[model samples]
Target: MHTCAPPVETLEELLEAHPSINGNFGHLLLLQKDADDGTLSQALRPYFESAHLDARQAFHADIGIDLHPDAGDGDGPAVTYPGCLPLTTRKGLFGEVLAGLVTEGYPLVGEHEWCVPIFLFRYHEDARNYLFSLARRPERRRQTVGRLGSDFIGLLLDENGAVIRFIAGEAKWRKTLNQSAVDTVMLGDLIDDPAGGGARVRSGKGVWNDLNNDPPVPIGVRQLQRLLQEYDPDGYDAAILSLERALVVREPVPLPRTDLVIVAGNASATRDTLTCFLPFEGTPPEYTAGHDLQLVEVVLKKGEALIDAIYDSLWSENADA
Candidate 1:
């Protein structure tokens, strides 16, 4: 689930934006699938097939999956062709990949030549552990959990190989973009009174809360540094050194940060195409950003079935005949 190299061409052809609304704070864009999903799904399939490339064996190789001498002896895939990832996991993954494509394809606030050098798919230990369950003789107990830090990260590097800007995002998918679901995620969940009669109040916990309180330097940057050092040391040598300088104890180099939030889901039958989960006016007061902010709302028709279809077809063409 790493690098699908940006510019997923079909995205441009498939999703049509409802007149972009520009404001003093940032831009708001609502993209909906062009009608005729049968054609749309076929067009979008290849990109996702590439996006969900089975990374189990490749990422785990460095983590000791290769120690078993029998590994790679057969020409067939060693891991699950398509392990049945939980519905939530699949939706979350789709959101991240969709956000990554948007991050790479769409223009940002200030400076925006973004590239996701490597996807941190290896960090998906839940997926990794799940694969292990099916691969071994006796199935291993599944580790049911979610990742801790950033949902997805992308960056822009300068000529000198120093990181100049970073894109950090939180992408979510819901079957319905109803008010309660939207409010609970973006703002915070309302708490009920113990006596069952008091007014409900926000819990002070949600996407906005997490974004506002993120550490100056994101946890993903450090994680990216480690992956770069391991996977492509020579290719990203200077990049690593630059990160080391920034990660140092005192007088660290400051990296400009950009935050993105994408909420994509099935559109309400009665909802207008222009309707969006995020505000269309000036930047929401919730964003305390010292850097840039981007928002995307992708509304689809029958998206769950499309997602399942696309994920099921990943790597299918390459099956051993």
Candidate 2:
């Protein structure tokens, strides 16, 4: 299977959202855990399991880990799970997966049935190279790193089963959604003070900046096309061709694109709860990317606690059996 099922009911029950704010350039959403709902222990594990499904499978395969049903006889390879990854790596993976889940579950940019058929976790060479290192050259240190390129990608297929549009996403997770933290992501990180007179300067490169400069037909789309062709050629033949037509160097077909940005974290203590990181009344000035944009803010309480609990529970039933 390309992607595991999202826990739609679980998400609906566990989280609450403010009414979506619409603008000509994009729409903004703010979501947070619902305090009144008391069954987070039950509702959340399934939600996180769905989020990390691709990473668990992809990472295990990439690192040569194997799985067998109830094989505790010590006759097979160790079944490594992504749940055991370092805190940073685990947090990043959650952001990416949650972004895709929201993109697919909700009607964003007037599309439905958004499919994230492949996750690029296998291509996170930092983890693979470090984890797969052998005795010849012992691994220097483990790298808690994220995959390069777009963090999330989803395709919308037409009645003919050809891809009509795509959404490329930048998903980030922060400890707090304060202005400085938000600026460091949407705007560039603060550059070092050049002169003796210290001044916080931005590096002029950030998520919005990168998205503005992205090619109309993103490289992620090409990567997706190749994966589908290689893995399920007959099943995704039309999608592959449609992507190929759009990717051609000359006179390529123009495909509609949506930019998705998800910033998920705990609400900052210093900030009032009435507003969010992105502007609500109008399109964000930071987002110059002409494509339709869907901005999502996911704020949570005791986020790390929830993250740990949910991740630890993935496949626990199988492991315990």
Kindly list the per-residue Cα lDDT of model 1 for residues 187-220, writing each as its tens digit.
8888975556787877768888889999877878
The lDDT of each candidate is 0.69, 0.71
In order of appearance, the predictions have TM-scores of 0.84, 0.85
lDDT of 2 at 270: 75
Give Cα distance to truth, residue 210, candidate 1, Å. 0.6
In model 2, which regions exceed 4 Å deviation?
A: 21-24, 34-58, 70-79, 134-141, 192-199, 319-321
lDDT of 2 by residue, 1-321 (tens): 344666666667666656463643445455565542336644655555655555566666666665555644745433355654667877887787677778766666554578888765655666655555531244344546688888878898988879998989999889888878888888888987666477878876888898989989888788778768877999889999999999999999999888888888888777676567765555677777777787777888877766676666677775431
Off by over 4 Å in 1: 1-3, 18-24, 34-46, 49-54, 58-82, 137-143, 193-197, 319-321
